[model samples]
Target: MSTVKDVSKDSLHSTEKVADTDSSGTSSIHGAEAAVFEKRVWWKLDLSVLGVITMFYLLSWLDRTNLGNARVAGLQKDLKLTNDQYSIALTVTFVPYIIAELPSNLLLKVVGPDRLLPTLLTLWGIVTTLQGVIHNYAGLLACRFFLGLLEGGVLPGLVLYLSLFYPREHLQKRVSAVFASSSLAGAFSGLLAAGIMEMSGKGGRPGWAWIFILEGLFTVIFGVFTFFVLPSSPSRCSLLSEKEKEYVIQRLREDGAISKDDRADAFSWGEVLRAFQLPQVWFSLFIFFFHGTILYSLSYFAPSIIQGLGYTANQAQLMSVPPYAAAFVCTLVLSYIADKYHCRGAVVMFCGTCCVVGFAMFLSSHNHAVQYGSLFLTLSGINTGAPTITTWTANNTAPHVRRASAIAVVCMFTNIGGILSTWLLGSLSAPPRYTKATAVLLAFAVGLTLFAAINTAYLYYQNKKKAEIRATITKEDEPAGLGDRSAWFEYIL
Candidate 1:
């Protein structure tokens, strides 16, 4: 039997070996030297990568959800769209969106995110800008479908991309930074919509036209900038010194981070299938699916919901700002806490409970103040829950290809909720009060809370079982592979 001291010494020696190994599996940098480089350079690397990706996601989300703002700014009135036709337009976006996610993520691996993401952004920007010129319902439908097709890969692609740069324990805060951009975009879209709608009849175009044109143009410009600024991978980054790059790679290896394999490895269908076999993947899918239904419905309908409460269009747009802003702040704080504690399941459950409570309040109340206050709870809950689930899923998956496939699968299923939300919230049958929609939202929230609780318990059970297995293993019997399935690679609960 190995003594505790012997196990501790072996662990220290193993960690040292991990820090020194180079791409060819020979010792290069001293462990202390690599540690110093990491301590000094990690922040600079994180800032550059996180800043650009956050901005990209912000614009992507703004273009994707800005239709809600446009609707309140007279898109339906200008296009002579009935409520069902408008809902159909929204639903159409998710068809191509869902279909494109897995393929685009696979392509992202083959081509590289720096190349593929920017190209997708540019094409979607053009499509979004063209939405401004649509004369009738069919044109709107066509633009929205293509827009979804082009935009589908971005969020999932970025999630996979970030996994390359950061370790599991450090991921949620960074992922939250990207996800929070959506909330910030939500807030900015409201304020921008109010200002842009003031340009009604400018250049012989309606205010909603200006909203799409101007925002889409902004996305195009930023997409161009991103092509130049974003680095493809830590090993290939021009911004880092050779030593810094090596240190980054070494730290990731020690942390059992994703994609430790050389990028030259052939695409493995076996690995892709293995990703689908993980229970975590399906759990993550359900979590995102339920949360997304509530999240998208709120994003698409909040302004109208507020307007139905007796505010003018501009007032409703402005009022929409607070809920999103509240969500933005809460997402960042909750993600930071989750990462610090290494407790994603707990954070997700808490957020789901908030969603359940918030929606229940909205369903039961008639007072505008109480209802509006409930929006804060709903947005904050759903927004925080999203990144927690995403990061948790990403953290558990490994090898670049498998992570890509898992993320795509998770995102593909989640967007199905986007389609469902359009009809559920945008139905002509539930105007003014939208009582039916609110009730459905409440049911989804309850489901989310239940799902999260069950997931947490299962994770705990898995962890306990893994602990028992680890206790029986001697150093000589340890697995050679890295990542979550390895005997030493415990899942972050």
Candidate 2:
């Protein structure tokens, strides 16, 4: 095994040779030594990078989804809110949320993730904590809006950050880990809410209030810790030695990773416009839109759904836990299989099929046992498919700013589904049998299945075209620069 020092020296010596642009502008590697070095350092990178981002996402989801838990803990009753008003509170968040994602991602490119992500986390934590103190519908709406505004950048920002470190083939599992953290947070939020509800009158605060306060505090603490813990990029990560860092960067180069020059360039409106031109970006937006409908509906309404099954409020909270826990496990497994086989499209379509079946079962069955069992499939399927779609978009896009814009645009459109979900599921008139809402969600699930199939077929066609081009083009005839347009850059299906 080559030592870190040995790898670093070899990498430095090879830089000139690697930088040479033969029409493709991609580096060729001296194989086995590079492979050995990568294997040696990847585990450390995964632990430090993926671990911290996953934690941040966990806390973000915990704070965001706790509103559902709070609603069950008597938030609506105390605020004297009708179901429509409560729905408005949820819907208002996405106003700022959608407007902020694109600009925030652009800002992230300027300030860097280490600084930007923690700052967003801390601000959202403050907003989340303030939700505990809101007395009226107006106050609650204000807090929710700010919470969404502050949180808008997190998912897209983290996706872009991960893209900087991992190759296209390796991204699905890391993205899944971050998403599984969200599922784990959903499960944990239920248990935590159940416990916090026990503090209903403690310190002159209601149980729902306590849930926000405690979870927000936890987020703030973790956000502060992340600022010190997360390195901005591979080259800046202090946890690794110089040689390890060299190996990481070298491997990325060999794999045709986006260059630092592309990442560090000044933000351009041209890149943003180019992102919109890509068909994959539009397909991703539609895919995630339906995905958001299912995901946010569950995150915000699962407890209510469980309560509708005639469980007690507390029992409903506990029942919510199992679906999310199942989702956490299934998401990890599904993502692992997708990455291992390099079959993102197939895995996504499979997960979408599960969602469709789950929703169909929910609509057709009146038996509580059958409905409850369906919750597991619904949560697991949507959770698994959401990250897969996100990773798919991120993987196919190129250059840092364009990727950022593409993700932000997809997230922006997708979250409109969030707003729709709140209105659809939070209807005051639709009580125990929200039959209408379930039917709508079922339609969304069917839409997801259709979108996944279409997107997969499109990607297959593009890959076939790229393969043909690669066969005809000489090295000197290949498209240059770091973008995905290179003749050799095939889309991952």
Kindly list the per-residue Cα lDDT of model 1 for residues 435-460, writing each as its tens digit: 88888888888777777777777777
Q: Measured by TM-score, how close is model 2 to the native structure? A: 0.92
lDDT of 2 at 62: 88
Cα-based lDDT for every prediction: 0.83, 0.83
- When summed lDDT is taken over every stretch of 10 residues in candidate 2, the lowest stretch is 11-20
lDDT of 1: 0.83
Per-residue accuracy of model 2 over 1-493 as CA lDDT, tens digit each: 2222222334212322122224555444445645554565667788779999998899988888888999999999999998899899989988898998999988986798999999999889888988888889889988998988999999999998898787676778889999999899989999999998999999899999999998998888888888888888888887777756765675555445565454434577887788988888888878888888789988999999899899999999999998998999999998988887778888888888898888888889889999999999999999888788899888887777888899998988778999999988898328666788888888888888888888889888988888888788785776555366666666777
After TM-score superposition, what is the CA distance of residue 428 in candidate 1 from its true location, in Å? 6.4
Pairs with backbone N, CA or C atoms under 3 Å apart (clashes), candidate 1:
none
What CA root-mean-square deviation does each model show from the true structure?
4.7, 5.2
